[model samples]
Target chain A: MMTALLVMIGLALLLGIVLGYSALKFKVEGDPLVDKIDAILPQTQCGQCGFPGCKPYATAIAHGEADINQCPPGGEPGMRALADLLGVEPKPLNAECGTPKPKSVAVIVENLCIGCTLCIQACPVDAILGAAKQMHTVIASECTGCELCLPPCPVDCISMVPIPEKVDNWKWRYPVIEIKSLAV
Target chain B: MSLFKFHGGVHPPEHKLKSTAAPIRSVTMPLRLVLPLRQHVGNVAKLMVAVGDHVLKGQLLAAPDGMISAAVHAPTSGTIAAIEERLIPHASGLPDLCITLNADGEDRWGDHQPLDYQAQEKSAVLDALRLAGVVGLGGATFPSHVKLRADDAHPVLTLIINGAECEPYITCDDLLMRERALEIVRGIEIMQYLLGAKHAIIGIEDNKPEAAAAMRLACSQNSISITVATVPTLYPGGGAKQLIKVLTGLEVPSGKLPTTIGVQCFNVATAYTVHRFIDHGEPVISRVVTVTGRVAQPGNYEVPLGMEIFDLVQAAGGTADDSNGLVMGGPMMGFNLPSGHVPVVKGTNCIIASAPALFAPQPPAMPCIRCARCAEVCPVNLQPQELYWFARADNFEKARSYDLFDCIECGCCSYVCPSRIPLVQYYRYAKSEILASDKARQAANVARERNELRLARIAREKEERAAKHAERAVGARAEAGGDAKQAAIAAAMARAEAQKAEIVPQNVTDLSPLVATEIKAIDARRGKVDDRD
Candidate 1:
């Protein structure tokens, strides 16, 4: 009985040491769950989620501080995707956050722009290009359709223009299938 | 030659005899032509002519924008009316940039010389072909020069000319082979030389015996041996990969190009255009289009590039009274044109005036019985039922895992579905969704990178500004040599004094007499307020 107890104790100690070594060797640098959640987010950098940016919101969600359905720019599809990833039930988006709108890019009314650098400072992606007292133009391709630049513009020269559907960006719609109800 | 068969295909009824009854004829040029820049598959051509500019026949109206794009040429001498968005012959029924040309009725030719391909360098010849706007006329409209480009890794061994014309009611390639077989053979020789292939084979469906005979005769006349092998008639047998498989007995790996297998396939009509461009100095200004179904006189006519479909139907003795809609391309893989007013594009091989009698509306889709009928008819050997389920559930990831992109959307599975499900439509939806999501994901990644970089730059700038202020503070402390706070207060006082000294009034001299009187009254009131302070 004494020998069996000693053997069990010895095995436990060895297993503990191995586990400790593995813990040190394969230590992850940051919260990978936060990164995964951030990847699932649309990365619009819009602060409708009551956070500074998408990454901060992702961090809050990872820490259980923010709900998944708070992002309006992500819309219902993104919430569903997050639910699937995080193993949670999807709830309707919070109506107070804002409603989802079509994708748009900020267009600067060049002549009306008072050369204020506020819009450039407000942009998260550095898509707006201008200097002090110079006309600023938005790089349409790079602008993530974030409306952050609009309110900061003193002259209100920045306007969010919805991107138009063209042949290049056109997508095939879902097929229509009619299902007869059996209850009739 | 021993030909290999693909996995699955369906046999649709051939209504080609009605269009093949007569010889290919040229249609009268319409007064107005509307050419869309995005007729081909790749990037739209860059416009070269402005509105109101006169263009001659064969004049380059737009140049190819990229390697895969093809140039657009003026069909006849015309004045450019407008370059604006107009309805195009597409499944989406959307408007794209189109060039409207008003024909001058002169029927004049632009200054163009035949390309001496044999004497000129191969690259030069390919460039000339690209400039001449020669593209595959077998409905894909892929630039022929891009296909003819030689690759060092996979040296082409056999070149296959697709004469299958497998789709029902599309007789453009068939009639071209019958009438211009010699010229097509010459074009094949040019392609063979360009690709440096050892041998060539012409694969025609057994249904077109006359075309095979003509092609065989033309091949016999040539010094270089060109084999004309007639394969069994099957739907979609003319697809580049399918014809390549039949001619060479090799399967192009899924998602890989035929060139990777040392085999290159070109439509027979594409070869005819090459010959015309290199030998006759003629560009792809017109193509033989088969106008059939519910039409009074069904036949193939050489229609100009941008002629309206209504005029072409009129040229074919007009559509029957019962005609309901018009379809571009064959019944198997074609899409219904938005309207009869859409212009003829390079991909417009055949225009079918479809009616309720010719094509009955499909019945409502029913649940799958799991009979596996769709699997039996899929030419690409993909499981259509599984793809349909995933697509219906919006499970694009699952559908992609099932080789959804490999589906050519040939409609063979839809034709064979026992439940009458629109299986191809589901696959198309899934494929497009996958593509759009992929594009979105890429754009998101780019935005994320840009945002991160901007944040880092802002942080760096903030740190630099702080460092510079710290350095100035340290320098001020060193210069003061005693109390830092006292020196800072003295500097602030000096800065305020300088600002007060630099103040100037610019409106005093320019003020009008009435404004000056109002200013004097305001100044007197301000002096009384200052006295109370």
Candidate 2:
């Protein structure tokens, strides 16, 4: 009986030592999983998902503190991808954040810009190019059309416009939706 | 040369006799010629002539924007009335940028000079071909120069000329082979030399016996290593990959091109056009197009590019009273033209005047019973039934996994479908949706990248501004001399000391009794354990 007790104690001690060593050997600094989740986000920094930036949202997602469907900008495909990655069921985008809309880019009415720097400070992407007391312009190519700058622009010169489709950008039109025909 | 057969191909009835009996007749130049800038599958040609500019025959209206595109030229001496949007002959019925030329009726020629390819450099010959606006006269209309380009990594072992005009009611290629077989052979020789190919194979459907004989005779006369190969008469046998498979018994791997397998294919009519451009100094201004079905006098005509289909139909002894719709290509692959106002482009091989009697309308669709007829006739050997299901349900991921993009849209599955599922249409829809989604993802990625770059740029700017501010302050102090620097250092040290003095530690005596008792117990337990050790 004494020998059995001793062997149990000895095994427990060995297991504890191994666990301690592994804790030190495989120690990871910071949450690398959060970074991975962040990499998949659109990075608009729009704050529509009730977070300050995409990184915070990614951190929440990694910690299981937030649902993957909260991002409307990412749309259904993005949600599906995230769900696949997380091994969870895909859900519809959370309507509380916003609905997915057609892609657009911010355009500034050049004549209407009042040389205010508030829009520049509000822009998360720094897409606005200007200096103090200078006319601000949105770099259409760089702008994410997040609409964050619109709220801060006192003059309200910024507007979102749909990108025009050209011949090179034209895609095949979907045919008339018809069921299988009986004709041969 | 021995030929091989492909999988699951249907033998469509060849109606070449309907138009092959008549020789290629040249039609008079139309009053107005409308040339769409994007006739070929590449970047649209850059506009060279502005509105209201007088141009001569063969004058360049637009220059090729990139290597994959072909130049656009004036079919005849004309004045540029407008460089505006016009209806292009596509299934979408969308308007594209076009150059409207009002013909001057002079029938004049420009200063075009032919090059003796044997004496000239290969690159120079390719450049001449590019300038001549030569493209594949086949339905694909890919620029000829791009195909003839040599690749050292994948050397061309054989060049196959596609004479298999397998689509029903399309006899342009057959008639061209019969009339201009010698010129076509000359073009093939030039291409073979350019590509440095060891052998050239001319693949013709067995249905066109006279055209095949003419090509064989022409090839023998040339004394080149060219073979007039007879392939089985099957729909889509003229597809580049399909013809390559038949001629060389090789399968072009999915997502790869025939060039990767040391083979290149071109239409026989394209070869004839190349000969005309290189030997005669003529541009691709006209092509033989078969106008049959529901017309009073159906025949092949050498119609100039940009002529309206309405005029072409009229030239074919006018459409019959029963003619209701017009199809720009063959009945199987062609789409109904929105109207007759659309102009003929380089890819317009045949214009079938479709009617309810001639081309009967399909009955109501029935649900798929999984009969597998579509799969049996699929030339690419895809599971058309499964693809149809996935495409209908918008399950693009599954469709993509099944290699949906590899579908050539030859309409073979649709033609053979027992349920009349319009399988190709669904596939096209799925393809477009997938493409659109991919584009969206790309746009999103680009936005994210730009945003990240912007963030980095902003951070750098902030750091630089802080550094500049510090540097400016230091420079100002230095300019004030040594006394000022010493005084500033003393002030900074005093402020640091004052800030440090503001922070004080809380006294241990202020702790609550409960916390103090817990700390004492913890300390006593630790002391007892230390003593035991």
Candidate 3:
């Protein structure tokens, strides 16, 4: 009986090795689209896309579930870029999440802020750096301008202040190409 | 065609109770008006009248610049207040070249000449239609003359007047057919004459029984050959292709016009506009608009092009409690205005002051499980699942290969997705991106070809010069002072070359990797998550 058990174990090990070798030899190349979508999205942990985060949203889009236009923060250009990647026609950004405005970060008026955590909780990307009792400060560079944090501030202390235009941040809008579209 | 249609259409709840039964109503001339130059599909019309210029109703304000464009005229006697870039009814909220007018209230007409279209030849009718600035009033705003002039190779045999106002909550066209059936018939006759078609067919949806009865009565009275056929009240059964299929019993081949099948289509209103343009010498300046959806009052309104969305809302008795701004056109194809400040355009069909109750605000979109529902509902018979896959993966090549360019972006696939995936948006994005890439590729190709020609030109010129120099041997010694002068010249040329090399080539590094990595990484991760979902 001991010899029989040893033989069974040896056979199982041998089978595993052969299967693993075969799997490694004939692996399918992953979709290159995943990389293209990930590149267009602003890598913020913004849950505004309804996905857990930007990365997840990109993945969902890759899988054919999520549309490229849901990210209001990405605006029309981003939608176009995603559309170009996906080979779909781009529509206007879904107006449900609000119109795409110029990039803005919710600024907390320290004097007016009631030290409430409402704004903190409203932040989809957690770009606001603060505690419950402390006046919140916006991480300007990290904010995606989704405006999620502005509404929940009980005191109305948060306002979407537009990012100051500077040489560093000022990039020309990607030139739009004329597309021949029929009235669909 | 299959029993079920294709992707991206929505069944917005029909709120036709208010205006469906109500007859079409004409309103008093708006005191002020904004007429955009680029109201149609082509180039912006050249401004013919400007600030302080007095003009009567029917006076041309902007003249067509391109062959595929239309001219603009005053809806009422008015003084031009300003001509500048103003917000027009567009989804992107971009400014358009617009002419603002303050009505004089005289509402006087110019020396109008209503013609007898039957007496004239087809070219005469087309010329008259062009001069009057008539276009397809079915919201496409395409030049009517262009459509009327069918290709000789595929001569048009029939005229299809679309009366299928199948969009929920909008009843303007239904109201028009019910109230002004005879005028519509007259319009159909004019379109028939213009195209020299064998017959004309008016397609009214079954839902509008009153409209069908009216059209049939009008057709019988005029002894017109036009047939009023009642089609199913499908949301986009009114769409050009769908209507053509329903009428002709033949599908329009993909990427080709209905004219290819010897059929040409125009909206009922467009026929009327064409009639008025040729017979009565009237330009397309005014048409019917339905003011409804989440408002205090709703009705069919005849409004001029470039009327403000806000004014339309006000005319409908102001907004209800849950007003969420406005969507111009039917809920299915209409777009939410960025601001109510945008004025109406030629394509403005209905203004829906939406609310969460009527037009439910979207919730979080969950991941798709590849159920293929989007592909199933698509009227265009497109495989939306495959599109979504390539699009999400950003594999544009694959998406294009799947005929992503053919997607009409009708918002039907996105509307029907059980997971609430916004499929129309994806198609739009893909289309735009593909266009941009294609343009880039074209420009690059043109540039490369041009550069190659330029280099070859330089080489040819060098060879020709050498041959010419060889023809004159003695002049070579005279042309150059000895070896000392040649050495000096060579040194200067070397220095100039060195300066150009140091300043130019190194500065322009290939950005493919930097960009490919920066954007592709985020996209790949997005793709990866989609795989998991």
iRMSD (1 decimal) for each model? 0.9, 2.8, 17.0
Choose the strongest candidate by lDDT.
1
- Residue B249, model 2, lDDT: 91
Better of 1 and 3 by lDDT: 1
Best TM-score goes to which candidate?
Answer: 1
Q: Order of candidates by TM-score, top first?
A: 1, 2, 3
- Estimate, for each residue in A71-172, the C-alpha lDDT of model 3 and write its tens digit: 876677779878877889988887765566665666778899777788766655455777878778877645555566776778888887887643222222
| lDDT of the candidates, in the order given | 0.92, 0.87, 0.76
lDDT of 3 by residue, B182-285 (tens): 88898888778667799888888788899999999999999667788988777678888877777777778877888888899899888778767766778888
TM-score of chain B of each: 0.89, 0.90, 0.83
Q: For candidate 1, what is the TM-score?
A: 0.89
Model 1 chain B scores worst on lDDT over the 10 consecutive residues at B477-486
How high is the lDDT of residue B455 in model 3? 49
Give the TM-score (vs. native) of candidate 2.
0.85
How would the docking of model 2 be graded? acceptable
Tens-digit lDDT track of model 1 for B1-533: 89899878888999889999999999888999999998888879999999999999999999999899889999999899999999999999999999999999998999888777889889999999998888878888888888899999988999999999999999999999999999999999999999999999999999999999999999999999999999999888888888888778899998888999999999998899899899889999899999999989999999999999999999999988899999999888999998989999999999999999999988998899988888888778888889899999999999999999888888998898878888888888888899998998999999999999999999999999999999999998787786777788899999999998999967799889999999999999999998999
